[model samples]
Target: MSDAVQASGAPAPVGHYPHARRVGQLLFLSGIGPRDPASNAIVGNVHDADGHLISYDIDAQCRAVFANVRAVLQASGARWEDLVDVTVYLTDMARDFKAYNRVWAECFPDASRAPCRTTLGINALPTPIAIELKCVAEIKSPLPLAGEG
Candidate 1:
């Protein structure tokens, strides 16, 4: 059976779905954006009081997205090292990929430790942010509080 994961410390999902789901040893995360958990605000974009888009910084968005993903993974009892695959969505690959890659490198550091990833250029996303990330991770057993035999 699969169990849904909703991280209380993360932003509430924009939709009805949980942030992640765990099935056996695998955990699947939903598309994670740069929304601040406390404010529900997009991290890298500036908007007017009327909610009109102004400008954005891709690097800042990338870092926030990664941080949000990390929070989801941890809530599911997984870590960055446990990630097996990741899918990245970008509204403007031509403009944002380089900076995003740099932040990604900082997170993984060792090339060998980095998870397999695919990045796609898209027309748009649910939010005004430039990037989002979703991933799958292998969950290690013997969880600290899962249960005791």
Candidate 2:
């Protein structure tokens, strides 16, 4: 059986979806972006009065996206080291790939423990964020039942 997870520490999903869903020993995270949980603001995004895209800091977005992903993982009773795979989406690969990679290296310092990754350049996202992550993690231990100490 599968169970859905919602992270209180992460931004509310823009549409009808939970943060992650767990089936058996694997947890599958939805596309997580760099929006703040409390404010729902897209980190590193700047817009004009008309809501036109102006500029963004890819590094900041990358860091925030990782944090968001971690929140989902934590809520799902998983760990960073439990991540098995990640798919990254970037709005501007040419301008942001290097900066994103730098932040990625900071989060995952050890290659052996890092999960498999695939990064893609996309035209745009549902939000104004520059980066998003879709992750899959393995739950190392079975979670305790509710009310069980």
Candidate 3:
């Protein structure tokens, strides 16, 4: 196997870029958005920041991002608890930070023992998306089944 597998459960593969890649024990996931992996519909956030079809709910967005993260981990045969690091990018840091933290706390409690994280404020993001999250994880090798021998 290419020492890894590409995770593709999102609404759509926005571009040619692969959703995730695995090299030996390490798995790297791309930025995640709040949308239905199948329909590509933005989740939660009902009203757009400037009032448009493209919108995002803070909690929903967080969940969607994590959902995508979870999918990638599973595709690589990994798990959320296996995550070692994460990076987040936001359009408006001041406006969304508080809400983001609320959701973050729920998603990653005791992050100190979870994984290293860094959030940054950006000018904008992909169409209809406000926040994106990426992460790194270590996939554990699977042992033989209980009675495979």
Candidate 4:
């Protein structure tokens, strides 16, 4: 049976789907954004009250995105070291990839231990956020028996 995973400390999903789903030894995370859990506000967006784009900071968004992913992983009994693969979507690759890369490097650190990633340039995202991350992670630790642990 598959288990839907939702972390209370992570940003609420914008859609009806759960933050992640676990089946067998793997956890599949849905599209995760750079929104703050407490405020439900998009991070790294610099827009006026009318929502006019002023400037954007991919770095800030990257941090929040990683944090959100981490929360989901933690809730699902996974960790960064258990990540197997990831696919990243960016609204503007030419303008934001550099900053996003820097933050990604900090998160993964050693290339040997990093998950395989695919970065794609997209036209738009759900909110004012410019980036979204989705991943699959392996559950390394033993899971509890249903209603037994």
What is the per-residue lDDT of model 3 for residues 43-72, given as tens digits with 9 covering 90 to 100?
A: 876765777665456777778888887887
Estimate every model's Cα lDDT from 0 to 1: 0.89, 0.91, 0.76, 0.91
On residues 82-143, what C-alpha lDDT tens digit does candidate 2 reach at each position? Answer: 99999999988999999988888888999888899999999999878888899999999876
Ranking by lDDT: 4, 2, 1, 3
Residue range with the least summed lDDT across 10 consecutive positions in model 2: 140-149
Query: On lDDT, who's better, 2 or 4?
Result: 4
Clashing pairs in 3: 10-37, 11-37, 11-38, 45-56, 45-57
Q: Model 2: number of clashes? A: 0
Misplaced by over 4 Å in model 4 are 144-149
lDDT of 1 at 145: 59
Arranged by TM-score with the best first, the candidates are: 2, 4, 1, 3
Give the deviation of candidate 3 from the true structure as CA RMSD. Answer: 4.1
Per-prediction RMSD in angstroms?
2.1, 1.4, 4.1, 1.8
Best by lDDT: 4
Q: Is candidate 3 or candidate 4 better by lDDT?
A: 4
What is the lDDT, from 0 to 100, of the residue 6 in candidate 4? 83
How many residue pairs clash (N, CA or C atoms closer than 3 angstroms) in each of the candidate models, in the order given?
Answer: 0, 0, 5, 0
lDDT of residue 36 for candidate 1: 93
**For residue 146, what is the lDDT in candidate 1?**
62
